[model samples]
Target: MSRRLVILRHARAEHGFAGPDHDRSLTESGRAQALEAGRRLALAGLVPDHVICSTATRTRQTLDGVLAELPARPSVEFEESAYAADLDTAFALINAADPDVGTLLLVGHNPTMADLASAFIDDPGLVSFPPASLAVVDLEVEWLYAAPGTGDGRILDGEGQVGKGEG
Candidate 1:
């Protein structure tokens, strides 16, 4: 059976929050972007059956916004390791997903999110994941076999932004 992975970058966050980076919350526009991203995913019928999300405030908020527009209430896992995860760590998290899930959504910070999304495709240069941006990848293998270059992915919604005009 075919599987799908949706890699999402947390929405825009305030540069200057009183707390740590992990505690930073989404900006107003970021909330709008997150909502739009969810709508677009729903529109594209990319609703996930399982979600692996970062435990950070911003990522959780982004997840909340995205989940709001989706019809399915996916089983979610709040992982602290996903907060500032690397590509390997991201893969580990992904590989640990429920094998029965046909679609999986991962929400986290960038560099990792961007790198993970790009790693699934042949041409990494073609992807640019801005805040609230998402990449939908179709995989040929099970979640246990997921790895870089294992799937073909495309940027959905916008190149580096979501809900540009509406937000």
Candidate 2:
């Protein structure tokens, strides 16, 4: 069975302008971006059955912003290991996702989020996910076995768009 996954990088954050990255909270625009992105996902019928987010403050805050706008709240889980986590660690976490969930959303930090999306969707060069950007990919396989460039997944087009007063 195919598994649908949406990966979102945390929105722009403002933590006194200088501090720990993990502790950074979303700026006003970031919050707005998250809301807009969530609306886009809901409009596209991409609301996840289960939501997973990195344990970083920014990531969780991003999830919170999006979840706040959802009609039917899905189960949300957090994994600290995904904060600044590499691609390998990401795959392990993804593989461990519940098989019963047909759709899973992962909110995380970048380099890994971007890399993983590229790995699964085969469009690294074309699609670069900025902060608060969301990519919806459908993999024609089980979740656990999904690896970089290994599964049959394609990027759902027109998912990324610039926001008003985007940061």
Candidate 3:
């Protein structure tokens, strides 16, 4: 089977509306949105093999929200490198991923997430990543070779705030 990369932009943050960039936390609404996204992912049977998150407070909290909605714990890694990573840095992270991880869940901020998605999502009609959104990109290679701009992926399915069986 082909490996997959599931890119998730963290849910809305307090900084998005009320604080400085680096120290922001997830608002109550942001947590709920993140849980909603998680529930949707669970319902769709799209849980990843592992979950990697940025150490940024917003993404850390977002990972918690996602984990709260799942049946069991997914292995997690909090990477300092993921924070403020540009496209090339992000690409290196993705391309050096473990090959056995059939699916990798990356919870991070925008620009990086959007930039990575844009580089590979083959659908001309698929663009835009609202907060708490999930993008399941189907790939045809090992996880370690799935570079940002060189991936062969298509947007398989997309959803938000979906209840069980609703998507």
Clashes of 2: 0
Number of the predicted model whose lDDT against the real structure is largest: 1
lDDT of 2 by residue, 89-163 (tens): 988888899999888998898788877777765443545668887766667668888777555444433444422
Please, what is the whole-model Cα lDDT of each candidate in the order they appear?
A: 0.85, 0.76, 0.74
The best-first sequence of candidates by lDDT reads 1, 2, 3
Error of 3 at 105 (Å): 0.4
Alpha carbon lDDT at 37, candidate 3: 72
> Candidate 3, overall lDDT?
0.74
**Model 3 per-residue lDDT tens digits across residues 6-74:** 778899887554555767888899999888877877876778888878898889888888888877677
lDDT of 1 at 103: 95
89-148 in candidate 1: lDDT tens per residue? 999998998889999999998899888877765562554678997888888789999998
TM-score of each: 0.91, 0.86, 0.84
Best by TM-score: 1
In model 2, the runs with Cα more than 4 Å from the true position are 15-18, 150-167
On lDDT, the stronger of 1 and 3 is: 1
TM-score for candidate 1: 0.91
